[model samples]
Target: MPDETLVDVWGLAPAVLVIMVGGLALGLVVAAVDRAVVSGEAGRAVVEPLLAGARGLVEQRRTTLAPDRLLWRIGCAAVPTLALLSLAVVPVGGRTLWSTSADLVWFNAMEALLWAAVWLVGWGPNAVHALTGGYRFLAQGLAYELPLMFALITAGLAAGSLRTTDVVAAQEGLWFVVTMPVAFVVFVAGAAAFAFWGPFAAPAAADIAGGVTSELSGVDRLLVDLGRAVFLGAAAAMAVALFLGGDAGPWLPGPLWFLLKTLAVVTALVWAGRRVPVLRPDRTVEVGWMVLVPLTLLQALAVAVLVLNGFYA
Candidate 1:
């Protein structure tokens, strides 16, 4: 019996490995493909400018535009780096690479701090365009951030735990999206705006003819573009994990379900990028604050009432 059990365990190990590896590979590929598909006049208009700025920084003469050179450099590099680090704690599957109690709240807080870093980067550059971009980013950030937080809080309330894994487990029978459809939509819209994609691309728009990244060049620009793509992927993954019931499904496996859901969300963002015209900065900020924020908060309150009354149970 011992020998038979050992053999069965060995057989299952490979399958387990395949599922984990396949899920990761799928997420990366989908994100990359999404980026590639959108890399054109419409898309490249945003990316290419940043690349140009990075290249300019490297090849052109270095001019000290600001009094505090060190501060500027640090601001430019730190925001994206911090954003990547926060992603580490987010649970990808059965376990996160590093997780602690209440990790979900920590993750959200760290992720939100990224905007501050980005703002600093723009301000440190001391260029007209960069400053304008930074202010625009701040305006948009103010508008969407509250709604995003409410969405996350609603998920936590539903799960009754601040751990992402617990949240996923709580959705055994039905996804949170079904129970909180309005919150899901609100969260997605807020995330897209926060990430500066689609209609909210105003802060980095080519029509603003280069907003915050207008001054970046060479490797710095590359880093910014890469960071944006990675952020896009991460945000989509979060939405999948939170609302879609992270890896919950039948026959295929949990991780595959996770990847499929993430891909679908990322694809939608890319499609929206292509279909929607970039919004004016003023209009974008106005809509986000005046409309989406209150709507999301109300949705959260409804969700709280429903879950508390055991309607979702």
Candidate 2:
């Protein structure tokens, strides 16, 4: 039985690795596309200027905003760096790089750290807009984080383990979304808000004139932008793994199914970015904490009761 377990684990390893790498690569590609192909105005933009800006940053002279430049650079770079590291803990395609019975909890905790790093980045810059952006991010964080945690806990209670692979397997007949549709919706909203995408993208919106990113330029700006895309992809992938049964369908290989699901989520994010109205900061704060949080908690209680009653079985 141990040998069979090892073999099954080994078989799943490559697919997990591919998904992780693909998540990172997709992030960079999306950043490049955003810089080059997609513009805020939505028309009369081309990729050449974007590539030129990227190339110019590499060739241009470095500028310093602080006397202690090294710390500043580290501050801007650390968030995405840590966020990418945490993505490894998230399960994809029936496995993670390191699997633990408590992996789901660990994954959620690390994800929270990603937000901490974002606050650090904002504080590091020492600029007014950056500071304001950072505080806004924290406010938004408070609004969405509880719902996100409750959603994960709901899944954990339903699956009877904190292992993400077991969560996927538990949905063999029907995805959790089918039974816990409300929780699923809350999770997606929380994920999107945490990612700072679509209607929740107020911290980085153009009206704020690139709020957190306003003062950033050259390679520093590139890294920040790239990191945002990476976070988006990672969040979407986690959503797929947790609630969508992580490549459980037949016919196609597990990895392909996983990619398809992630793509769908990504497309939704991008479309929302284009269509949704940016929420005012006050309204966002109110809705996030008051409405979303209570709804998610209620869903968690509902799921817990269902699981206890053997509805999941």
Candidate 3:
């Protein structure tokens, strides 16, 4: 919100582009690692998927009956766009571009766009499977998204500021994960949900015949998948910044510490994907409302109490 700390408007677009490419690449690697674990394949599984995605560069786009090509394309485009946007506010160590006083709010809003982007992708196809997938994402969003927002709020409250740099600085003495374990856990669950990874992947699952992606092919499909991975990476990076004492360590540079922490969180999520069972779409709602929402609310309240009592100070 403060002009002194905001990203330069002229430099913002270019920074977003550069970060998007790097983030997307890192996201693919994290996803590849996770995929290999889940499929019982070699660690080199990233190779085959890379080749397949490259082939998509030349693969022809497929169409569904009565499809709205414009809306569908917008949906495809939005996936990576939103992923790129998420990193704009978050810092790498203490360095960042496009940050603001309300960066936490900005990040959350960009992520909320996932629901719209996903639903549009599903709905534009005009098929039973795709439509159902779109609806499923909406349901999933309602369930997981609220708690995610609350978790971010809890962090913001603890820091006494909504900016990410402040959040990182607040963990100078101790990490938020130690003080707010419930919120951290809920936030991790929300990250998996944001990427629609295992245990929260109903919208894109095989049971619904690949759900929203049933009608997708070629590079559009590649981008869509990569976008999901990129989103997961961004969430991991934010978790590092929020809960893991961003860029704080003995030997490593700040950026290296940040990178290491992000990878650790992403790896944990990938491992969870291998071990956790998928929650049915119906059950997702029940758990989200009955379990996640109340838990995050209590987390925030607890942080508020601690903050008021100078526990963090």
Candidate 4:
């Protein structure tokens, strides 16, 4: 094993290695904290997960009849993989691993992969509940995708660039959250859908017998669980970058500030996830098309008008 590698992999740059390990660790810790807070057993809550993981490690993997083994494997692993890739573009202070002009688009696209991943996982299982869970995720994308895009584009339009770093720069003095509260709210809702958290968890809800994941177990199940946490954490990190003025706080280093903001967003999402009522999959489509679409569109147009008049300038 290499002494300097986060995952015993060879040839990763120090920065990339740090971000990879740090991001995963951050997601895990936040998730444990959220679970503890929600269950009213804050003490030893963190340690409980370690024991749970040990149990999962020893559990047997289950299989179903006529399963698409390849797709099932790929889908099970892809969630966290995509999420880590998405996190690469998220700024920790003034630095990012691969900051590009297309970061906003990249972030959106990566999050969008949840649809395919979840569906594949469901379809691969060839079971009724699993397939239904996958279908619910696809339905979720339809509901949240457009509003998510417009909300993100609102930031890009204001900054006049699609770069995540640029969005942060544009928020130096005035965070977009102040001017585009509607967009911010929509962004959070969209993020929740992607994470299948909060009211958007119909796909895997009790009504569906645990839905898409009803068949998953062992390492496969662990990956999906951690991936969801990381996806939510990534969304929260992006919210900090795109709306809360990334790393612009006083009296703290950029990474520390970024961490603080990310934690705040994660806390909010977790709280909302527990408090919000789950929407039926059918109702989700209706609301996404009828309500969120028009609202986010209007928000985008309003942002366009403001940008055209040099409002943020």
Question: How would you encode candidate 3's per-residue C-alpha lDDT over 111-199 as one tens digit per residue?
Answer: 88888899999989899888898988888888888899999999999999998988988999999999899888888889888788888
Give the range of the ten consecutive residues with the poorest summed lDDT in model 2. Answer: 1-10
* TM-score between model 4 and native: 0.93
RMSD of each: 6.5, 3.9, 2.0, 4.4
TM-scores, each model vs. reference? 0.81, 0.84, 0.94, 0.93
Indicate which candidate wins on TM-score.
3
Clashes of 3: 1
Candidate 2 backbone collisions, by pair: none
Model 2 lDDT tens row, 103-188: 67787776687677666656666676776777778888887788788888888889988877788888888898887777777777
- Residue-level lDDT tens digits of model 4 in 151-193: 9999999999888877888898799998888889899888778
Quote the lDDT for 299 in model 4: 86
Q: Scored by Cα lDDT, where does model 3 land? A: 0.84
Predicted structure with the largest lDDT when compared to the true one:
3
What is the lDDT, from 0 to 100, of the residue 263 in candidate 3? 81
Better of 2 and 4 by lDDT: 4
**C-alpha local distance difference test of each model:** 0.67, 0.70, 0.84, 0.82
- Model 4 weakest lDDT span, ten residues long: 1-10
Question: In candidate 4, which residue pairs get closer than 3 Å at backbone N, Cα or C atoms, i.e. clash?
Answer: none
Q: Who is ahead in TM-score, 3 or 4? A: 3
Candidate 3, after superposition: displacement of residue 80 in Å? 0.7
Residue 294 in model 3: lDDT: 93
